[model samples]
Target: MNRPIAVVTGASAGIGEATARALAAEGFHVVLGARRLDLLKGIAAEVDGTAIELDVTSASSVAAFLDAVPKAKVLVNNAGGARGMASVADADEDHWRWMWETNVLGTLRLTKGLLPKLIDSGDGHVVTVTSIAAFEAYDNGSGYTSAKHAQSALHRTLRGELLGQPVRVTEVLPGMVETDFSVNRFDGDTTRAAAVYQGVVPLTADDVADVIAFAVTRPSHVNLDRIELKPRAQASASRVHRG
Candidate 1:
């Protein structure tokens, strides 16, 4: 029998990368997808997996990646990030569009494109990484929060749609993860990014990755629908224990 295959998007860094590693260690043949070919190559070498260039915003790119991995049993939709810290009143329309393009449309396109492949696998599973912002909006979360809401909605709908099928859909909503997410979102403002988790134990990429691994590694009969994880210091999306 062929080994189970897993496809992970945004596998170049953070939770995505960590999840890929964990899955690979668990003996799944992982396919790493991301725009950074170099980073993907490095990860693939380390994990003994295949690497595919994937730009989630581009339909052609998404299609190409899916075509390349036609027998994926597990799909991890993890390519997304916030653009700016702007309130709804003054938020840039372009930023909102970009966020939606990546967080919503990207996920939809990839999931839809790979649905047939997943269904064919007989034991397929989808694990999407959402955020606490999906449920609780913050002050400057106009664009990102809205996009995450859409992502979570997709996961929920997929769970319902695949209820009768053998496929399983899981959504993971994590809070205040200590990753390069904030740094990239803030355009490399390291100080600001560090301040976001100052004096508080934040969730690590491995933490979320472990949850994702657990979700996918369940028995064929068990389907984990939604998982919400937060740092002890984080009470909600708006409230975090700071120094």
Candidate 2:
């Protein structure tokens, strides 16, 4: 079957993995990319898609991943994470660097590398999974919020840059998702990660994936510019109703 190709970054787990599954179910030949070849291979096998080892933070890896993609009708920039939550006064430079590299440059590298193919496909879609932090700022979360803001800017700018082109740009901003995101942010502190979602229900990876699948499946002319989804218990980045 000559299915349209949909490339998903950070496909080893969480949102990336779920998006890969959702896109595959949508009949797109999903190309899963991540540092975990083991997990990527398994997910790809299950989805009947291609698995490519990718570290979006590395330009060479992005180049190689893009080259492996014969054609790209959709690109899902989901390979990003946050690090230590430190106040501005005590900000850890290393954490900040990692955040900038993975969340900002990572998205840039992948999106820029596959842009032409997306345009050439004649009906392309770029779905960037940013965060509610993209617009809202919270204490001790400067590292992540700033990076997301920049990523969101890059994705949003494409709207005008690709005007009159066949490509569509959509940004998915999710709030308080219960994933390894917190665990990684806390440096593998699973207990801390568990506490993040202890008070209220958080959005699942599949929920975000479902939204992405719907956005890309829309008619070619209908462009869903930006979508912000969160659980009912969440009102904003800092205003979650925890009981």
Candidate 3:
């Protein structure tokens, strides 16, 4: 029997990297993808997986990545993040566009590109890492929230379209995960990024990765439609107990 292959995008760090590691530990041949080839290589080495440079926002990049690994038992759509945290009125259109292109369309491209291979895997899973913003809106969260909402919609529609198929679609929504998500959102502003998780116990990359691994590792007869993971200090998108 051959080990299954798992492809994880946005895998340079955080959730994507951790998922690759977890799946590899579970006997899967993991392939890590990200724009940061250097970072991906380090994580890939740690997990004993292959590293491929991938930019989900570009069709060509996605194609290249898919061509390298034409088949996969699992596709973890995790290549995305927020650009900035600003109110709706003062929102930067560029930030909004980046959010949409990276979060929504990025996930869309990979899911569509890999659907056939996933179906052919016999027991396949498409797991998306959305955010708590998908469930609720918050002040200064318009840009990220909009993109996440679209992503949430995409998953729901994919599920409907793929019903009765061999592939399982699962959306994992995480609340306040402490990772490069905030740093990238703040554009390398370590001070600001540090504040987001200060005085609070937010979810970690491993936490989300563990949940995703559990979902995909379940029996073929089981399919986890949607799951939300949050820390006790976080009740909602904006209600973070920073104490």
Against the true structure, whose lDDT is highest? 2
Worst lDDT window (10 residues) for model 2? 61-70
Mark the regions of model 3 whose C-alpha exceeds 4 Å error after superposition: none
**Local distance difference test, each candidate:** 0.91, 0.94, 0.90
Query: On residues 101-220, what C-alpha lDDT tens digit does candidate 2 reach at each position?
Result: 999999989888888999999999999999999999999999999999999999999999999989999999999888799999999999988988988988999999999999999999
Encode model 1's per-residue lDDT on 34-121: one tens digit a residue: 9999999999999999999999999999888877886989999999999889887898998898899999999999899888889999
Which digits, one per residue and each the tens of the lDDT, describe model 3 over residues 171-223? 99999888888888888999999998999988889999999999999998899
Candidate 1 weakest lDDT stretch, 10 residues: 63-72
The TM-scores of all predictions, comma-separated, are 0.98, 0.98, 0.97
Clash counts for all predictions: 0, 0, 0
The C-alpha RMSD in Å for every predicted model, in order, reads: 1.0, 0.7, 1.1
In candidate 2, which residue pairs get closer than 3 Å at backbone N, Cα or C atoms, i.e. clash? none
How far out, in Å, is residue 238 in model 1? 1.3
Q: Give the TM-score of candidate 1.
A: 0.98
Q: Which lDDT value does model 3 have at 54? A: 97
Off by more than 4 A, model 1: none
